[model samples]
Target: MTTSNFHGAVGTKAKPVTSQFQFGPWTLTAVKSHILESEGIARQRFEGELELPQVPEMIFADNVLRLQHVAGFGLEFNALDALKLVDAHNDPLKVAVAQAWKEARADCEHINEVVKPFDWTFTTEYKGTLIGKDGVQLKVEPTDERIDLEKLKVREKIHFYEDILLFDDELSDNGSSIMNVKIRVMPTSFFILLRQFMRVDNVVVRVLDTRLYHEAEKDFILREHSYKESKVQDIQGPPHIVTDPNQVAQLLPIKRETFEKLIFPSSSISQKEADAIR
Candidate 1:
């Protein structure tokens, strides 16, 4: 068994969050606990992807600790209750779960196998487009406007064509260093067009969020395009950026509740109009 771990400064807490861990029959789940300990503290987001083998047995357990003065951290964990999986090839009690684990493992193995052949390279020809909130199309002159490709060369960044790949060290199998790739895209006019053909809005949302477009850009779209319609309401004001400087580097999704309530309620236009613009 192989394992991979990648760490990013996710708002200061040492806890991991939203990592596509390299190897595991199971993954650390979302933290159900959100206790605040300090006045200037921020919450941590913890999540993981799991891969379990066929006919396996496993158990999960945890231990909690209390901190004392000087903010001394106390730790507790049930190592005996560590990730475990039992083979249930014949047991009637484990048929469904066993089969599910088998399927999940198979999927992960396939992805690892397929992705291994890829050599990380900068994408210059993979032309991307951007669509605006209103329906206007923005001309994407890659040669002139491709300013971001250089910033990606910095430390802790690896661009995999359309997204950045992050590997987990603890869960890697067969020395496979990659766990998953995350894409960063602003929901511009061209993106909307691509979304139609690629179905990027659904599956892609897990890896990238398209709602990061600027209000000025969105307003430019509304002014240039004539069609306006939406199931939800339009946005009245600009997007409220997350102010915490620590979280700026971390990828996060647009708050769905906030999106529906504030932004989508006002600016979204009709699908028919969207089609006409295309």
Candidate 2:
């Protein structure tokens, strides 16, 4: 049987998290492992895309109104894990052959096919725990309690995408030699950022990029954009930024215990009665 026929051999295939990963201030704890799936049978036919989950609107609205900070948890990109893919596919022997083919203008597309196993994708569900700055640990349950808690339906979803394509030639033993790599955080990651501004102290998203050409000083560049509290003096954009990633990780609905203790704003009265009282 060809490799294309069976991608069913299932188990987590990832490298250990490197020390370089800095998740800013929030502490994350995960239960389940990240799952990797190949996009195609071979490198030539390979096409990959990140999967996005559908979250309900009520999840965002319900908690924001309560003035409580919602923490983001679950699976996010592991830049370090991608190196595993680069290392496997970009073997020196394979790179040499790919180079030879291009130099000779030869047509051997199997190179792409043989390297297909190295092109992989991962999905992380919102099932984990996050500790806020105040030391409150919210245990995120997988039951997806938005509907029952917020009276909100998840009719649509936010999306963020980063496509990493590693040709057989660009791959390397450590995945550092891989080039022409495009790293991006989709527009959908900014929802949790509101928490950073309104209540939390730190928030950030991670990105990884590999090179496509020789003479690149580094194998990969790890970068991240963090949110900071700033006051905007002009309208050119937001006080801190002009645009933002789409939001994710809505605050959990307020519980009965916390709801009863909130200090509500003063009730409104019509202006006519106020004028007479004055």
Candidate 3:
């Protein structure tokens, strides 16, 4: 494993710090930057939204976790793209939160004559952004391939590991919204997990997780996404458990799950070629 650290200039003034790790034919990079200033072009990009969290700056475009393969394929997790999954229209969750806010603030001095609706909980189902070496976007196709959890359970030396935060918001004291990614590289394989966890106090708890696993010498990466959610009242556990996404994730049933693969074009060989080489 080879590791390096540096600062990359995103703009004239913003120097995002970056850490990179190289293992086998893959390179993993994480970029982190300070909160976006309220008056910048970056902040303007999020304008026109019905409502943003108090710490909206944390979702600035520059913060990301990226993995690239020598074969010209890459995957990235970024806050900007993840937040796009937040519903702009009036979803059931949004409507419920709005009503709760209205009732909670019924006696407030400045109640608006009309209320705008949005997903107050900031729930999202973004997996990861896939792209090719030429900057063209790629799509993950459904596949039978799956990550071997038993293999991962075996004790192995970790070559590299990193946890990268994309964004986090307190949701105006209603609850919390957070998106983060973690990657671990072993001698024989690498694994990544991108998680988006949202908690709307007394309303709902939601989690969306994306897992990617790639074994050394393999021509493809297996990707899995699982979405789980449950109403706060329906979850049966210690009250404090609700505050921890990791613990609560086990309680919530899986609402949806998907498996896909990202194949490296350069690594693929025809059967005839393989036979000839043999």
How high is the CA lDDT of each candidate model? 0.21, 0.21, 0.74
**Model 1 stretches with alpha carbons more than 4 Å out:** 1-129, 144-172, 176-278
How do the residues 164-246 of candidate 2 rate in per-residue lDDT, one tens digit apiece?
A: 22211111111112111222122211111111112111222211211111011111112222222221232233323312322
Rank all candidate structures by their TM-score, best first, as comma-separated numbers.
Answer: 3, 2, 1
- Predicted model with the maximum lDDT: 3
Could you give candidate 3's per-residue lDDT for residues 1-278 as a string of tens digits? 45565665566765777778766556688887776665666666654443433224256567888887655567888877777777655445744565665565555432343345556566778888876756543346789878989999899999788788877877656778888999888987889999988888887889899999988766778999999989889999999898998999999989999999877675444334444553
**Model with the higher TM-score, candidate 1 or 3:** 3
Winner on lDDT between 1 and 3 is 3
Writing each residue's lDDT as its tens digit, candidate 1 over 107-204 gives 55443453222111100111122223334233322121122324333444221112221212111121111112123222222111111000111111
Residue 233 miss distance in model 1 (angstroms): 56
> What does the lDDT read for residue 199 in candidate 3?
88
C-alpha TM-scores of all predictions:
0.17, 0.18, 0.81
Error of 2 at 165 (Å): 16
Clashes of 3: 0
Residue 149 in model 3: lDDT: 91
- Model 1, position 148, has a per-residue lDDT of 34
